[model samples]
Target: MLAMIEDRALHTDLALERPVPALQAISHDPSLRTTVALRDGRRLTGVQAQWAYLEQAAAWVDDRFGADADADTVEVLQRWESVLTRLERDPMECAREARLGRQAALLNGFRDREGLPWDAPRLGLIDLQYSDVRPEKGLYHRLLARDRIERVVTDAQAADAVEQPPEDTRAYFRGRCLAKYGQDVAAASWDSVIFDLPGRDSLQRVPMLEPLRGGRDSVGDLIDASDTAADLMAALAAR
Candidate 1:
């Protein structure tokens, strides 16, 4: 059934006859073929990608046995590395074959050797566990607590990111506006923020066409000087 669907997709929307430049680039770029990405927007590829897989598998072994991990984890890592190394030879083609129903990308052969049959329900359960977002219940957070998942940023850094937008981007200006005068803001989009002020006949739309223009350095003092949204608008108009 999957193969038939894959065939349909390949011959239709994803057909080689109709080439998308970005997709074509991804096919050729090994760095873009990462199966895992970090929260700090870093891609795991090459040795880093292999190491990530090993780290997860090793952590699982440690979790189960609570023993010296070196020996117990080595065999599993070797198997995973073997599979990943082979896949990396032609990652895009490997992915295509897997999608087009090639019996789960050589892992099925290893499972057969181990006398373990394919288990769709078990796979689905694992997927569900990973996606669970509750910190106490999620598989990922559990691993995170154990320091199994690699940390790209400190807890404080992540918390700070949640509270504030990047200072270098136009989001700083937009975020400051929302934080200060969100009640007056009727609507907002990427390119503009619309304000519905008191005693105003029409909505005031502030254009944000230049992403680099509205950063902290550009508008921080202006925003600081304005007492209200109306004052800010007037100051902008005078400029």
Candidate 2:
């Protein structure tokens, strides 16, 4: 079922990567539109794209689980549906509800995985995940969230990321590999790409995990000021 959904997403107008920017662009320019196909064979556009996907997911949950789903899963799905319904009415409340619901779902997953008692006080996990909601904890929370629900990257940055590598981390090295090797990069496994540096005697292997630590390694000012691969490499090397 997961594979089927993923296949559909690949073929449909589902902007899975950097979706916030895509939605924003669609809102501003009709020419930059995207559509999502509904279960009824109807294609919804603009702001409806995300909602349609959520509705489809909800439908899948209902169809698969029906009345036999565990209590925790059913409760989480109910909350998700409620949040979706509130999208047209109270978006702020909807966001808050969704967060709480996600926290609940995460707790349930953790409990099941660890074989912990269901009644255990796992709300502390939310704080551990999101930290305190203070300004000082903003970066921590953003780093933890990453591509989940966080908007760590700006819309412009997200848009550019689709085509070019982020010029603020080790991803720049991967981009350099792509530029130098072109189609040869694909010959390397999907997990890591090997690059032969101009001056280095040995081939360098760039891992796909490079960008994951960028938030911790990159200085805000340096990332903002970086305009070249050299700048990013210098910043990363400094760290």
Candidate 3:
């Protein structure tokens, strides 16, 4: 779930954004148990319970947004209804559809809140666990545990990252904000931060959603030359 949230934060480019949807599918002995955690933090257990929650959310959207609701919002509710209709006929299909439909609804809800377009790329599903491994013998376990310490990012790099946006991504722009305005100003802004440049009709807002595009060598020169966040942004923009 944490990975999912991070992915959403880094990749969602549409004007709309929302918290990661909460849906857990646990494999039981003979069936799968589905759980839905609502935005209010209420957990709905069982297929029936989840369906009921969707129904309420759909109704609430209609009541709250009324004529202002977008087509995606309406479609999400309709999709839920269709999934519910299939519950008795095909339980498996119903479960699959319910998950997809609920995800769409959750994302669209963000669009409703911000009055933004729904054109961002949909999130791809990621498997969080591996299932084929069996317990090893004591000797095998000891051998495996020998090399348990793994270091992906060095401590120095992580410390630099706190103040400098990654040069390979849009985060470089965000780093500029932090550099110019200080941490408090940058931390308070989200999605995009507006800047009052000279030529624009209105303030320019820089989005921080683009993923890292640099390789090991891509940001080397910029990192070496940069003494401040502003310098880093300028070097990255020049690149």
Candidate 4:
């Protein structure tokens, strides 16, 4: 906890001129690679395809941004790359991340499309994927553990009371609010009616928000944080 605060204190946002030269450089590179072969005489371009896409990483990214935009975009893209590197480990970590990520998406997608609240009971895809792994062992166990971390990370800024709580107890608290807010966060701020949810069969009470107001801002923040949280969780789980 102390370390996280220190790291946060030392954090600095990179300032770049819009429209960095990344795309231009990528454009200049000949984006191509030799396809590979497969066993059983099955010829597949897996390696070549991967390399080809890697070579064109900056192509799909718009390069017409102004100087400031370019720099900011590049920084965002670099951070995204770092995140991908963290998640792209062995199959075990990938599976867990995939589960956690899909769950986040399932919840967040409602905010983007339904014009509705992010209620909890509407599990849908997340529940389906989660349900298929009933016997929580092997990959599912890792995924469950990862889910706990995901829940923890989603609750960044949980509360800084310990000898060093998480880097931001608020972030974690926000996550707790998000998970508990059900589906009414589009109108009011969570702070308006936050309370503790009943524990699971006599467990300690966990803080939860009654309704997540200021839905736009808070949901957006949760999604952004969840993005990096997914990567970080996958990496740590792998280790």
Candidate 5:
């Protein structure tokens, strides 16, 4: 397993070294070939892009463990070293990304705190309007009751809360309303994104990227674990 993780890390390193200017080229990048995008319209800086590459690689490495394996599994704990190698390839990348992130954050904070650049894109959000496509409101109501969601949401602001929410419980019952009516719904759902370009009153819809988030390291971990498991299995089978 460790060896497998090492191999994937090597590949990621190779990808980083053999840089293609276009972020789109990542789709063709050898190993996982998975896609990532910042919460839809979000763009990543040089460092964020680099970290995201390793993070996903780490996630794939970790995911290789058997279902029963706990986080404490010897294999899981040891995987950190593999992750270290991948991220440490160029420590400056981390620092660089951190600096960029902080700068952006500071700028945003100033915008909010001091109210500078009212003309700047003012923390736009995709205001998803719920459509009735839930199974039943019971389960959804139960889930949405959590503080994280309830804090921002008010009463069922969408269609008549169906007795049974749409087949897709999470989507059909987002903050007590479905943004879209459909049988298949995923909790990892975002309604038609409303992008408020700077200087626009009404939010406009724009193309959202796949993978609502970027830079999750689960994929890298899983890949490493799978490689380890496969090697062990292969060796055992050969014997």
Candidate 6:
């Protein structure tokens, strides 16, 4: 965003005034080494597409701004390159990560060089627009309502997700714990949950390091039968 803005403001004739061509060329390449399926049945191709885009953008920045460019530009680009390179080990994951979402404001800002002045306030508004959570007010929600954006999950599924966790994941157990004993949970993470049970000498840290274990199918009955978190712990320990 900064690069393009500065590019226009200074009349620098660098390539990629808009990222459309670069994104399109990479994504639609016939010789793509990898492809990943989106939930909407679309396929994303190109393993190093994002890495290449960033590299191109970095070059543009260097050419247009020279020493006036941000000091961390190279470092940020390098970091993105490193991450993308590592992701290439899994082509599907790499392809999925390469997918980028953009807002109308951003595209308009890029094209309306004369209208939306390349300034801090405009940039900040564009950057922070998505952070608005209200469905009626948020720019993202408005786009969603207009079907300008694709959804990975439907509204019904999302609503159900609020009250239920996946039956096949360890999240089921964690969700059950929260539902039955949220008051006892002091902290929770992907691999563990800390329980601060009353009358206990110390907090009990339950390690859920096994990602494949503790699903609803494996522990639903046990959880349903247990009256308290301690009872559930005892039942789990018995297993």
TM-score of 3: 0.29
- TM-score, per-candidate, Cα-based: 0.54, 0.30, 0.29, 0.22, 0.19, 0.56
**Comparison by TM-score, 2 against 6, better one:** 6
Residue 167 displacement in candidate 3 (angstroms): 21
Ten-residue segment with the worst summed lDDT in candidate 3? 123-132
RMSD of candidate 4 to the truth, in angstroms, is: 20.7
Highest TM-score against the true fold, candidate: 6
Worst 10-residue lDDT window, candidate 5: 123-132
Scored against the true structure, residue 127 in model 1 reaches a CA lDDT of 47
Per-residue C-alpha lDDT of model 2 across residues 135-167, encoded as one tens digit per residue: 456434553455445333576986887667666
Question: Would you list the clashing residue pairs of candidate 3?
Answer: none
For candidate 4, write residues 1-239 as lDDT tens digits.
Answer: 13323435323222222224432432332221222333333332322333333334443343334344466557655654543444444213332334434445445566677665645555454456555655553434445555632342332344433223122333444444345453423322424323232332332222234333323343444444443433322332453
lDDT of 5 by residue, 1-239 (tens): 35556555443332333334445554433232334444444444444465655565456546764455555554444543443443345332222222222234434565778676645553231001112235353323333444212222235634344443333222222322222311122223354323233444554442224333211231222223433323322332453
RMSD per candidate (Å) reads 15.9, 18.2, 18.9, 20.7, 24.4, 17.4
Clashes of each: 0, 0, 0, 30, 42, 0
Q: Rank the candidates by lDDT, best first.
A: 6, 1, 2, 3, 4, 5
Off by over 4 Å in 4: 1-51, 59-63, 70-76, 83-89, 93-96, 100-239
Q: Find the candidate with the highest lDDT and give its number.
A: 6
Residues 64-155, model 6: lDDT tens digits: 77778666776666667765665556423332223232443443455487465545476667557666888877767766677665555789
Q: Model 6: which ten-residue window has the lowest total lDDT? A: 91-100
Residues 1-239 of candidate 3 have per-residue lDDT tens digits of 23334534223122112223333242221133445454455554445554655655665666667889888678767876775666535544542234333334444555677665655433221111111134353322232356422333576987987876656554654555556545323342535555554334554444554345332245556655766544555666787
Angstrom error of the Cα, residue 158, model 5: value is 45
Model 5 residue runs over 4 Å out of place are: 1-14, 17-64, 72-106, 115-239
| Two-way lDDT contest, 2 vs 6, winner | 6
For residue 21, give model 5's deviation from the true position in Å.
Answer: 10
